[model samples]
Target: MSVAKIALVGCGPPSRRWHGPTLTELSKRGAIEFVALCDLDETLAAQCGEAYGVPHFTSVDEMLDRHPEIMAVDIVTGDPSHHVLAKAIAERGKHVMVEKPMAITLAGCDVIIDACQRNGVHFEVAENYFRMPKQRAVIDLIEKGILGDIVRVRYVDAKAQRPFEQTARIRGLTRPFSKFGNSSGMCMDMGSHRLSQLRLFAQSEPIQISATVKRYRHSDEFISEDWAHATIEFESGAVGLYETSRLGESLAHYQITGTQGGICDHQWSHPAIPLRLQMGEEWKDVPIEFERHKVDGVDVLSRIVVHTDPQIVYVNPFREYAIDDWCVGHAAEIMSLADAALNKKEPEYGLGGRKDVEMAMAIYESSLNGSMPVKLPIAETTSYERILHEDYEARFGRPIDAK
Candidate 1:
């Protein structure tokens, strides 16, 4: 079988923890081969390349030239650079799987979608939550009319302690790839997962998004929002509430209600934990458990080997529990991508080229503009594209071809 050549951009944590291993495993399985590793930092490029046994390049153009058969680009760049790199990939006629919040702003997202559409290339927002076993099970329940008509949803993704204080510095280790703060805030950083999942659960497009964003203290290190709570009105008449913060340490929680019954999942728990039926009597936690396998071969006994003695075996994917998080849904996304690559069937995750960045922009715009209820399905000509085109032309002193 011919190997699918891929260029990996942004050597961040996701790249190291998720994309890197997945690609390596795919390479071992003859699914795809890493042709190049690109990063702004020469050392990181060299390190990642050496680790993966792929060539390292500080310049993407050079990598493309050396390996013109590149079929895909794995992009994990920060928000500001996402569009620029994605646009380049689209122009080059390469499939792209990008990490969310698709683009920093609405217009940036439009440019990406338009370019991909015109280029006839596949674009997928690497949203893993939608593919999680428990989450998928809940979605299945909802789809089967088990929950009946969806009425309301409350999603709270809170941490027990301040995230910035604990994880910000560690996260900033990848700052060289892009402006860390550009997409580091709770709003775009973590909120995207919740919002995207909400849309999937509702199985309908949102009509309007009203958001309230704030930063209690100023930090030059990061420029993105720290805390945000958003309200969304779906076209199906489902009202949703989403709250996120770099500070919430109590619990990572989720709850959804319908006319018939309700479902809930708490921190470090399974979506199949319990199903409560609103019978004539009362709501009770029905004992339902689904065997959730952590895809990265993680188990209770593996902890000592991975943490206490790292040199004894391969790296443990569950160091911070994010291993289970990514492993929870990685197979779904990978299988989906593989199917699209081989069978020519559109996968649910951007298989038809859904404009996720457009949705993201709508959320950002709603937040930026005083939380006014902004309509969904924003036009392709968003303000960022308009304003940026002008700025680009002015800066270059020539008409710019954004397409």
Candidate 2:
């Protein structure tokens, strides 16, 4: 079996923590040829290259020109660079996979989509939450009709600042939040993932959104909202409520309600919290099992099974590579690109990433307009996007669409 030849751009924290190791492991397993690494920061690029034992370059054009064998590129850079990098890589006739939110703006996402289309290359967004074992199991159960018709989905997160501050302190970063640039506040950052999950859980497309976004703390230094609440109405008649805060006590709640049954969990991604299901006026603990095996001294999840009347199962395709559950999402993303590049197949989540961004943009647009409801399939450049575009031009001294 032939493997896809792949390279990576961006040697930032995400690369070092997740993408680098996952790519190296995939290469060792003969899944893909991890060819090179690139970053504007030469030192960071060199460090990542040395760690992954791959050639490195400080320039994207130089890397692509030198390593023409690279069939695909995984972009793990900041949100602002996604569009520019993806377009350039696709124009070079290589498949592209970008990190979540696809791009900071709808216009940016369209730039990527148009470039890939003109170049006849595949494009994928690395939205990994729904690919996890537990998430997969839940989706499988939903598909099997165990949950019946989805009626409502809710995700609440509180005290997000605790972890954010801890990570910032450890990294020794003192920069305040910016209105536009590397980060677009909590809504677009983590909210993108949650919005995608909510859509998937409800098994519907968002039609309307009403939201309020506010900043309670760091008013002097933070230009973006630290608290956000949104109510979404989906095409399937399902409703979703999302609330998040960077302040307050730590708390998490995720629940999916359906016509016949529902699921509730207190924490996100904690497998120890057994999924509880309500059926026939009784709420009971659903037996959840994780199949595992030892590989390279690591206990890797092989599959996850949810005990319903008819069993629902999610078997990890990369279990043989010894990828743990946490990195399983990353492995799946890489393999998704490999499959798209080598087999000429569409990615598992091709344009779905754009939909996630659209949802987030709706939330922001609604918030910006005094919590007025916003409709889907946004027809024009949003006011929120216009402000970001102006900010981009002011900071970069170039129009966002400039080549």
Which prediction has the highest lDDT against the true structure?
Answer: 2
TM-score of each: 0.78, 0.94
Judge candidate 2 against the unseen true structure and give its global Cα lDDT, from 0 to 1: 0.84
Quote model 1's TM-score.
Answer: 0.78
lDDT of 2 by residue, 19-53 (tens): 99999999998989999999999889888899999
Per-residue lDDT over 204-244 for candidate 1, one digit per residue giving the tens place of the 0 to 100 score: 77888787665543456545455567788899999888887
Give the distance in Å from residue 233's predicted Cα in candidate 2 to where it truly belongs: 0.2
Clashing pairs in 2: none
Shift in Å, residue 347, candidate 2: 0.9
Q: What does the lDDT read for residue 344 in candidate 1?
A: 54
Window of ten residues with lowest summed lDDT in model 2: 167-176
